[model samples]
Every structure is written in structure tokens, then in C-alpha cells.
Target: MNRISIIIPMLNEADHIDNLLTHLLENSSKENIADIIIVDGGSTDGSLDIVSKYKSISFFSSPKGRAKQMNLGAKYATGNILYFLHADSFPPKNFDTLIITEVKKGHEAGCFIMKFNSNHWWLKLAGQLTRLSWQACRGGDQSQFITTSLFNNIGRFNEDFTIYEDNDLIARLYDRKQFVVIQKWLTTSARCYYTNGVWKLQYYYWRIHLKKWMGADAKELNRYYKKYVC
Candidate 1:
């Protein structure tokens, strides 16, 4: 009977927030959801107004960084499990039941494999690879869920990271062998890739992952992302 708190960190995401929230409400039972919390990073795109109108959801403000916003939402969550999701990603139907089922089975941390909303062959292949439990295939777009106790134990997402925070947290989970990959798929927006060009965007993304693995500092990593991806 553990409830889930869906925490989303967003900035200028008005274009996607309403539909995403509606999908979540329609697909999951209110009884299984303690609350949906939207932690805004000073959004100026009317995203705040949209979230505020949602029933049974809480709204909070935070400094403009993904990690900081998510951590802030975690602090205010009341559910036993915290589900961190992207504003542009949509989980499968009955995802709440799936998460509760896995948690009851003792899988404390995990995420659904994700497919980009693109028909491109490379994107399809990338999505397929996420079905494997290998660490290399994981990313924030897939969305993450972890027991509140375990999240507290691990000290939560590193605020030092302006980006790549999800991978950083997943690396720790992997180190402790405390992660799993649910077979279901979350559909994430491919807007970034489309806007930046699929091949070019992916190259920079892969490079960032490599740099992080090679011990690049958070500042250095963010610099590269801003220069290349943003």
C-alpha cells in the first residue's frame, strides 16, 4: 500500500505540462498517488500557472537547475516512493501499479526503458538497448523511481550537477547493485534531437557521458553541454 509521489523538475515547459499531467491522472489511480509535485525553476513560460491549476498536486519554486529542483520536490514529498520524471516523458498505463508491484517485491530503485518519439532507426536502436540492464543504456528521459528511505540513504541527487545528475545517481545505484529496469517503456520527447539534429546531438551527448566517465568536473561537463547541446 505504498503511495508514489511523482516529482517533476521543469523550466519553461508550458507546452508539455498540461497534457503530461492529464495523462498521469488518467492512467494512474489517485489512491496509488500521494501527490504530484511540480518543482519549477523560475519558469517564465506560464508553466507555473498550468501546474497550479491541477487538482491534488503541489507546486513549489526552486533555483534554476534540474538537480536542485528535483531535490527540492523530494524534500516536500509525502509518499513512500519518489518518482522522478521529465515533463516531456509519459509513462505507460497503470505505471503506478507496476512501480508498486516492483517495490513490494523488494526492488527499491529502478526506471522504465524509454523510447524516443521518433521513427528514426538510430533512435529505435537506442531505445531497444535500454531494455538491457547495462548502465550505459540508462538516462533521465526514462524516468526514475526509488524508495524514499533508500533515496535518503544515498543522500539524493547531487546538486553540484547542472546536468547529467540522473546518470550520476544511477551510477551510485549501480555501484550498490540497487537498481532495476522495468520492462515497460516510457515515451520521451525527441524534441532536443530533432532541434539539434539527431546525429550531432547524439555525438555531443555520447561525448559528455565519456567525459563524465573520465572524471570531468561538473562545471566542465556543464560548460560542454551548454556550448554543444544547449
Candidate 2:
């Protein structure tokens, strides 16, 4: 049996963490779960208190960056596979079995197809695109699963990336042809879209992609995100 470590990087995610934990615990088998590691990026919103209430979770504080926090969680993970999940994304039932089956078949890394929790046409369209194997559709919100050996080989998430870290890692996996899109759909929060306005958030996301394509470094991407999204 392959052990699985679910690593969640959080910052002021108190509202969603408990629900996410409950869902995960209910859906996953205790025998397959190596540990649940929550690496908080200095959350002051009672996130720590909620995490403390869950005996199955192991928590740590890292600098305020998702890439940094996730890498920190990976460093302490003892599982054969490391599952990087966002607090607001919920994977399908039997996700553990699905991942282990794929690994047993020799797949090194993969992510679930995802649906944003929105009924808007564009969001639905965007969710549909994730079902395809295109690298452009990949994102951390979909939740990534990779063998620990493969993760170590890739050097883990790039700490320099304050944004686009998921794309960066996916890009590398694509280059090696080690990526797969599992058929199951993971549901992710569309709170950003609702909070930032649907079209406005979509436009900025495309702009950031274009900036990265035009050789914008991590700092440049971070600046764009802070100005537009944060």
C-alpha cells in the first residue's frame, strides 16, 4: 500500500479549512493516509485554532508564499506520494484509490480534472477545458499528486514563484511527458471570480499569462497579482 500525504498551504483560510478536513477524512481511508500537513503562511485568522482541533493534522508555519509553504510541507512529508491541494478545492470521492491506481500503473505525476464552483457560462466553459490534457489548463487549484521520488527529482515547487508556481511545475512535467489529467472532477472555489468580478479576474489572469510568456520574472508576476488580485 502506498502512503499518501495531503499537503495544504494556507493563509487566513479558517472559513474553509475545517470543512475541507472533514470531507477529506470522510472520503479517504485511514490506512492509506500517511499524514495531513497544513503549512500556514502566518495566518492570524484563527486558522491555527481550527487546525489544532484536528488530531489527524500536523501543522507548521512558513513564510507568506504558497510555493514556499508547499515546499516546506513536502520536506516534512513521509508518504510515497505527496498530494498538494488547495484548502478550497475538494477532490472526488475515492481520490486516494484513483491516485494509487495510477501510480501502480507507473504514472509519475497527475492532477484531477476540475470544476469551479460556479454556474456562470464562462466558468463552466473554463472547467470543461481542464478535462483535456493541455498544460495550459493545469493549476494548483485542481490538486496535484506526484510520487515523492518524482517530486524530489523535479526539485519541488520553485520558491521564487510567489505566483504561477503551479504552472511552472506543470510546465516542467509537460516537458518530461510525465503529466496526466485524471478523469475525476475536483470542485474548486470560484470565490475569486465572484469577489473580483468575473470578466475582470479572467482578463487579469490572461494578462499575467502573457506577461510570463513575455519573460516576466517571478517578481513581475507577483507585482501583477498584488495589483490586480490581492
Candidate 3:
């Protein structure tokens, strides 16, 4: 029987951790989940305390980088399927069944289409665009599900990336034509866009995509992100 190990690499996500966990339990079958792993990267906002409330969750600490954190989680996971999710993204109801169905059908890697929790027009448009099967529409906020063997074979996520780690791995999957976009919607928080201004954040995101496409290294991308992610 296939099982899923859900890995959530988070930093200072106190507001969403509890709710996300509860939602996961309410929506997924206990038998389908091998375990829920919470890899914290030095969160100071009592996220650890929130996580500790759930004795069933496998919680641990890691250095402050998502790639490093997720890779570590993958190492400890016993499940045949690895589901990497963001701190504030909530997958659709019975998401586990959906993933297992896809895997049985031979989709070794994929993510559900995503939408921001916000109702801003541009955000709405962006959500609509995600319905397409284009690689550009794919992102970490949608969450990722891959078979453990395939994930290991692909070298997992690149630890060198302080950011764009998700995109980097996703691009390779697309190249191999091994990526799928499930029709369900995964809702993600747009708090960053709210705080940073949607247009500004979106512009910088596009610029980073352009830079990455131009062959900029991870270091350059991180520097550029830090310079404007305010």
C-alpha cells in the first residue's frame, strides 16, 4: 500500500500551522498518511509550540533554508510518496486520495492548480491563469507531490537555492514531461503580496523568473530577492 509523507518546511508560520494541520487531518484518511513532518527553520513566533500540541506530527529543526529543510525531511520519511507543502497553502479536500489516484495512474510528480485566498482582481486573474498546463503557471504555493523513488532519482530539491528551489526542481520535471497539474484548487495565502504591494511583488517575481531564465545562479537570485522582497 502506498503512503504519503507530508513535509512542510516553515519559518515563523505560527498563524497557519495549527489550522493547516487540523485541516489536513480532517480532510485526509489517517491510513493514507504515513506521517506529517514539520521541519522548522528557526521560527521565533511560537510555531514550534503550536506544532508540539500535535503529538502525532513528526517535528524537527533544520538550518534556515527551505531546500535544506525539505531534503532533510525526505531523508527521514518512510512513505513511498513525498508531498511538499508550503506553510500557508491548503490542499483541497481529500487531497490524499487525489494524489494516490494520480500516482496509481502513473503520474509520478505533480501539483494541484492554486489560487490565492485574496479576492484582488489581479490575483483572481492569476488564479485563472493557473488552470493552464504551462510550466510558468506552476509554483511552490501550489504544493508538490512526487513518488519517493523519483524524487530521490532527481536529486530532490537543490540545496544551493535559498529561494526558487521549488521552481528549479519543477523545471526539470517539466523538461522530462513528468509533471501533471491536478484539477483541484489549493488555496494559498497572499499575505506577502498584501504587505509588499501586489504589483511590486509580482513585478519582482517576473524579474526573478527572467533572471533565472538568463542563467543567473542561486546566489544572484537570492540577492535580488532580498533587495526588493520588502
Positional deviation of residue 110's Cα in model 2 after best superposition, in angstroms: 0.6
TM-score of each: 0.98, 0.98, 0.99
| Cα deviation of 189, candidate 3, in Å | 0.3
lDDT of each candidate versus the true structure: 0.95, 0.93, 0.95
Superposed Cα deviation of residue 225, candidate 2 (Å): 1.1
Q: How does candidate 1 score on lDDT?
A: 0.95
Stretches of candidate 2 off by over 4 Å are none
Instruction: Please list the Cα RMSD from the true structure of every candidate, rounded to 1 decimal place.
Output: 0.8, 0.8, 0.7
> Considering TM-score, which of the candidate structures 2 and 3 is the better prediction for this target?
3
Clashes of 2: 0
The number of clashing residue pairs in model 1 is 0
Estimate the TM-score for candidate 3: 0.99
Name the weakest run of 10 consecutive residues (lDDT summed) in model 3: 221-230
lDDT of 3 at 219: 93
Q: For model 3, how does the per-residue alpha-carbon lDDT over 115-198 read when each residue is reduced to its tens digit?
A: 999999999999988899999998999999999999999889998899899999999999889988999999999999999999
Q: Lowest-lDDT window of 10 residues in candidate 2?
A: 131-140
